[model samples]
Target: MVTPGPTSPMSPAAWAGRRDARNLRAPVKKSRRPRLRRKQPLQPLNTSPLPGDSGVCDLFESPPSSGSDGADSPAARGCSHAPGAAQQLAQLDLQTFRDYGQSCYAFCKAREGHFHPRESLALQPQVTAESRCKLLSWLIPVHRQFGLSFESLCLTVNTLDRFLITTPVAADCFQLLGVTSLLIACKQVEVHPPRVKQLLALCCGAFSRQQLCNLECIVLHKLHFSLGAPTISFFLEHFTHARVEARQAEVSEALEAQALARGVAELSLADYAFTSYTPSLLAICCLALADRMLQLPRPMDLSLGGHPEEALQDCLGKLQLLVAINGTSLTHMLPLQIREKCCLSPSLK
Candidate 1:
């Protein structure tokens, strides 16, 4: 008897809203389209008087209603229609970011390529599986707890690996730099950038903004400012969406099975399973595996106990192979301490 997790009913109105994507409940007249609305910046949540209140503006501002003076606004006069203004601004910011990143990459490349090519240019004299495991052991828990998506974490790890493969910072500085690079990658990928202070706070003040900036420079110099590594979020999203859609025809239990399958797929992505496959292909495989597993007589629940145990075990196997391929250690993926606490032994009964 599997206890199902909370599920939100797919309401007709919600389904229709997803399809049309229009907010017609509060009707807007055609006259509003032509007039320009003033864009208001969101006020801070702290500014609000009510408890539990968050002051945030609507994603898109409503346009002003058109009257006899409709054409007189700045928007109507083409002030807001600059073709490349947004692009130009974005490019300028990217240039600045790239400049810092390239500087870091170049520094590392120069050190590894020229200064000490044969001197074990690895940030450490040696990075054994054990040491790698120890590092990831610390990193993974922190990352997951912070809600750092799997894909972003993968990119961070891969980026560090690529940089290390080329240029070796000292072992003492490696973790500091790795975390900084991860922070930068998160900022690049996530909608919200975790602030420097927030990260420093997490590290118990072991590192500072200046230190992070300096290390970031070195990493950028080594990698030539390349931040093009792939992430797992893309695959996770696609696979989850497809699984949800495919299971729509099934009974509620079947849907739960498939949804659980999707969760297993996501957890399986914990290791570098996504590295070999293109993002799209990885997405497909994850979905396929999830679908197959869910269609069983005793469907794998992906929950903490009972039938979900099998699905969880399956995910562990796949993740292990992926970690091996990427030359990463399993300390972060699954630690002995965690296994003991969860009562998950090698036998996995």
Candidate 2:
């Protein structure tokens, strides 16, 4: 009991040697639970509830089912579907649309001449307006069949005219040019353009794939890759959107008005007579005519300058006659497409 009772403290070197010996003897076993090297700093408990805090988070809450008819649900409000959402958003901001429409009209007016082909400067013998019209008439059904957009059709015609004006294309190659321009336009504007085979079939295989490709290259080169020019259809759409907002039209009614206006604009596109008229002027005329046909409110208050009421009336008269003539031909040629898209008979009449 007395042994080592009063042992003096060991020197530093001796204590270190004893610790090293103990350490070399065997590895120490660790506890199953991990031990922190240092105690964690003490933190005060949060006794108060968070602002706007509920018992549980919304992340844990179940979402409304797609089939649910709840008014607050996104699906029920038509926001889940792309097309419906687009339409809903389009109709939401009517208050600022008037200013937007005016700006579009003004910009189109300023750059109107730039959009037209060089009519006065004759580089070579070009296709006649009648030939152009015939080619476009054929292209329409093809465009409709492929489900291409109206903008695509407009761009195709633009590409055709710009190419013809700059390059000397023979009458034999006119159809080839038309199809090629359409191909270029489709690729530019469409999400899923008609393939080469489909385009050849549309042409009744009159032109080979190599020929089509060659013509597309030629057109692109001649036009200098300038595809940004706004067509009458572009201005027409802007005016129609503005008119729809101005009149507070129902979606169906707005669509009807747009169809009528587009029908008139398309007539202008087919006839070379409208080449003299600016796209802005054509848009104004189409909108005015559509408004009258739909028995909707007049867009007369819109800022249509650079021409008198008489001039607009005269242009509208010409547009009406062209629509009548084209409507007849359209009925005979692509009757179903025309009827379905333009509602030509009732609207034009």
Candidate 3:
């Protein structure tokens, strides 16, 4: 739901470093659903529509159905029938898809590449260099399709990547999951969520919105609503503020560092590389990349420009940790575990 919306966007000058307008991380989970808390004064900068805001589609509108189409869900098709039966059905589906391709989505896949799987973090590439070729194959064309405002698309990709970090999806299902996640994200962020039928019509003629919605629900359930995070735009704000306040060598260094950080994050999209990592890790990667680019050998010293060193350091440290955890051993960790030492697994629980 959207409200009248705030006329004034926060200016970068107001909060240097950590509290900079651009650096404001999107509130995850409950914070995203707006409400007035007596303890927290309303910041004029908070402009996003509340989850229950008016003028948006009513929540009561029929949630997409799973049985509208004759075809069963990927789960049902994958397991309810026999092994060979699923493969046979998949072949039939693919053939049908070939006959009914829609131009809505531009198909992307590298002609040559490999998927490197680590022991605990099974499907992630160890380094961007090793994964660049394949990642470019998917990212280049896709980025072309979704331009600068593509942060939402990136969010969707990040969601899929994060889900893949702990959940073991089959290699074959990767495209399906990625596309479906995009569909889900579009529904959430876009003024008009594309019809589920449009996506299916592009992939294969036989499917329906209901089946896609079911798959989306399955994916959402698996991810446990952890996909949303403050985006690069948030970082850009803090960086802008830092640049505004710095002078002389410090100013040059800060700008260089911020640019470098952004470059690193841009590189992340190549392989959906940031997916396995935590939010904190992703933030670190952005900073570290910037740090290295600025030729700063040590962690950023926010005090260089009289910025709130404590808050800046705290935020940066947390962000860097997120990036480090993403591609490393920590990629295997989940948000919260539940019942019987089980993960509250997405599907097989």
Candidate 4:
């Protein structure tokens, strides 16, 4: 055995063997050791209570009853909590809202002349405006009977006009066309649409279920599946809402005004003379007329430059004449279904 002396040169193999023997004889050290934990920054405690944090707060409060005198209550003033309340609250700047309204009005006003029923009538002379009005008048009772929304009613009329403009049909098929349009509108707008059986019954069996379905296909195809036209009622709702906000009108008063506006709009629907007015202009005129009837302190501001003042005045005069000729009272001129549903009698003189 060769004994390796300190400071003496040794073969590389022998040195390696010696190092391995020493490593094996020594105890193996573990690589793992307890890691030092990092400290986290502490959060500050909230000191103030948020709005509606108390159990007594009526955050999601209901509107005050019509009979109640609590018109100043938050809910009655349209301050009730709703879904996305926080988001709406964040955007509750009045000036900002008014600006948005003006912009929306401008946009809709720009597109107004494009959607007049007169344009449609020009193409299809066979479908006279008088016949159109008669059909729309009939739709009111049907709309009420089925409990369809105002949106559905307006959409139905829009579909009717668009389809009539593109395709010419015989006078006998007008009812069928109206029924199919109503079906399409209801399906698009209602959560649960009126069934085919209900529609057939409404038509008094004038149209077979197959005929109605086929007509629907024809209308849909003619319109290219575009049923998203903005109707007078759509703009009317927004204008009415804005009027309420602008005037800070009470809920009952607002409701009454809107009901009157809707009645006027429906009356316009029955007259071909109103067809020359754009939906926006017609809506503006309706709001203006309703405000006048109510004799409210604040008049609606509907003056967009280039608005046909002469035409609006002419239409308003016609509407007044219709109301006068139809019945002895304002409520009488309004469809009975609208009067009862909107509770218009209590507010109107």
- Best model per TM-score: 4
RMSD to the hidden true structure, all candidates: 29.3, 12.0, 31.7, 11.3
Write the residue-wise lDDT of candidate 2 on 1-349 in tens digits.
5676678889999999999988785667977986677568789655454457664554454453434355343333223211232343454455555557677667767776776775622554757777887998888767765656678888887787777677787888888888888889888888777788978887687889999988877777777787777777667656656656666565555555555666677777888777767677777787666666556654333353457777677788898777666666533432232245444435356
Residue-wise C-alpha lDDT for candidate 4, range 115-178, written one tens digit per residue: 5556667777578888888888898667765656677887887788878779888998998898
Please list all clashing residue pairs in model 2, or write none if there are none. Answer: none
Please say which candidate is ahead in lDDT: 1 or 2.
2
Worst 10 residues of 1 by lDDT: 80-89
**What is candidate 4's local distance difference test score?**
0.68
Model 1 spans > 4 angstroms off: 1-124, 242-349
The sequence of per-residue lDDT tens digits that candidate 1 reaches over residues 1-349 is 8999999899998899787875456665766457676699767455323444352332233334333343433234222211122222222233343446445433433443222112122345665434555565566655655556555666666566666667646656666865786786787776665677877777778877899988788778877776765344443433333333444323333333333333333443333333333333333344344444334443322331112445445544564344334322322333233222222223322
Model 3 agreement with the true structure over 50-162: per-residue lDDT tens digits: 47657354434533343335334333432221112233222222333345422211121111011112232355444233343353345434433432234455566555555
TM-score, model 2 to reference = 0.64
Each prediction's TM-score versus the true structure? 0.44, 0.64, 0.39, 0.66
Q: Which stretches of candidate 3 lie over 4 Å from their true place?
A: 1-120, 123-140, 148-150, 192-210, 245-263, 271-349
Clashes of each: 12, 0, 18, 0
lDDT preference between candidates 2 and 4, better one: 4
Instruction: For residue 177, give model 1's deviation from the true position in Å.
Output: 2.3
